[model samples]
Target: MRIRRWSTVSVAAVMTVALAVVLWSSGAPQGGRVVGLGSVVPWGSADPRSPMAPPPVRGQAGPVVGGLSASSVGVLVVDGGRHQCSASVVASQSRRLLATAAHCVWLDGAWRVDGATFIPGYAAGEEPYGRWQVDTAYVPPAWTEANSPIEDVAADVDMAFVSVLPRDGVLPEQVLGAQGISFSTPPQVEVAALGYPALGSYDGQSLRGCVGTGAVEAFTRPESPKPSEIRSLDCDMTQGASGGPWLAGPDADSGRGQVVGVVSGGDDTHLVSPRFGPAAKQIYDAADTAALAATAPAPSPSTDPMSAQIAPRGGS
Candidate 1:
């Protein structure tokens, strides 16, 4: 069972998006390194590695790897690196949008306000596209108002989007290429869940993935505010892999795909995500609108949305 600090007593087995990042951080992380805006920052308590639980298997997930697809997907270090989660760039007009789990942006009663940095193509301490700072976040109001996500209604809205400050006047999407997103897709379909897993049998160094058929999942707790049904599939990704993207029709060459869902919570056997629907579109638009109204990034030929579409977003 994935026990966390949700309550005074333990509950059923479920690996939450931000569960282990907050619980198992006591162990010395893989490499106590601090990175900010592409430079290795001074090591201290603010180190993002401090929050990651050490890999349990002598790196059983195999050697570190990197690729173009990983350019749009990155690790999110928030709250002064106290929390680590996965996130990815999503196609949008403003070219600065990213989708992740609501809990990754807001958790334990408040938003993570200290600081948040997104590192794309991070593998073995290498920052391929450099680090981008998160400027604003937009989450479902229903998720924020819920005192506890123990209810289906609240859990179903556990998605969020954030606008990141561009580097060198170029938006992230223009540099890494963004992935198309769809909200009307059905639950049952083929999917490729990608992220950086930092736990037993895996190492949080490179881009990792699991391919499977995804379907709707139901929560039958039989209580008031019972859990809502989410998308589930056979996957072993855990903890740091949260907020990772579930890609549909993934391209093996370009590493791009249409995003359908994100990694939310599941057990050792499978993973789950909020079914992207009207609510997701609402928030996506909200974030996009806000970014559009902000300062424009340095223009490039790839500014056209169709020019550089490559990867999808996630949940953590």
Candidate 2:
């Protein structure tokens, strides 16, 4: 998930409420164009995109308790390099698409197009299986431009999808497998949030959460926020919890969860999302095309490792 790396700002002088609004409304430029704040930037943005800024808070709030299902989430690393972000499997027809915050995948100006990897079901700082290399990532076009965080550019289109492959070119089904996706739902729906919070380890000292919630339609954004993708959640998430998944409904077929929004940023104690707006629909369409191609040829049990998969994380 995304965390604003603090410089030397002091606790007493830290402007919690004010900065949270500013950070939430801030934006940047990418791909030689201006983008809105809260939008995901490619790895190429220089100084345009900023981190998911949050207030100096203790833990996340709202319908939260622990974190998410480890089996469905993974650690997103830049180019198989150091771990920097988090992602969750959303669509798995062929392309192996993942859902996460736009900022988590994009940085500076370029979209970390290379050496990116996904370690599925990683636990306790352990990579039981090898890391899976990413093939490509998709970000909303509007987010590529620069904008204002206070305007709420991110609360809307904060989510993105990526295609991945094993370092050895093995199919995703050969390893941890992929998840399913759904759209066509109304707002203020119930969902379960999942992700990896680097700040909180499995250790007792670290406050990690794998929680669930049935809360619906927490709050809506202003008419014209910056990036226009952000929405508000009462959930209690913390730093290192950005880019998590806000699953909409239960996975009756795959037994996994349907993604409605991506955790992008929040205030001192709550989580924020990009309302699962039109941008999300656009990305999902593209991702569905990619996934279909990846699993071409009618997907047979012998040929398609995911054919028998009723739903997410390889169950049912």
N/CA/C clash count, model 2:
63
Identify the leading candidate in terms of lDDT.
1
Question: How do all models score by TM-score?
Answer: 0.73, 0.60
lDDT (C-alpha, whole model) for all candidates: 0.61, 0.45
Question: Taking the tens digit of each residue's C-alpha lDDT, what string does model 2 give over 1-316?
Answer: 2233211112211111111101111132211111212322222211121222221232342112122334456667652253345577665556466777666555434455456667665544456666776655666655555332322333445567776654465666545544555555564565555554432111111112333343323332334343222334454444345566666655411225676676665544445566665556666666555555553432223322211111111110
Error of 1 at 262 (Å): 1.1
lDDT (Cα, tens digit) per residue for candidate 1, span 6-108: 1101234343433223321335344222111011122222113322222234212222233445688888887667667788899999899888877777765
Candidate 2 matches the true fold with a TM-score of 0.60
Give each prediction's root-mean-square deviation over alpha carbons.
Answer: 9.8, 12.6
How far off is model 1, as Cα RMSD? Answer: 9.8
Stretches > 4 Å off in candidate 1: 1-68, 149-154, 219-228, 250-254, 296-316
- After superposition, which runs of candidate 2 have C-alpha atoms over 4 Å from their true positions? 1-68, 147-153, 166-170, 200-229, 251-255, 291-316
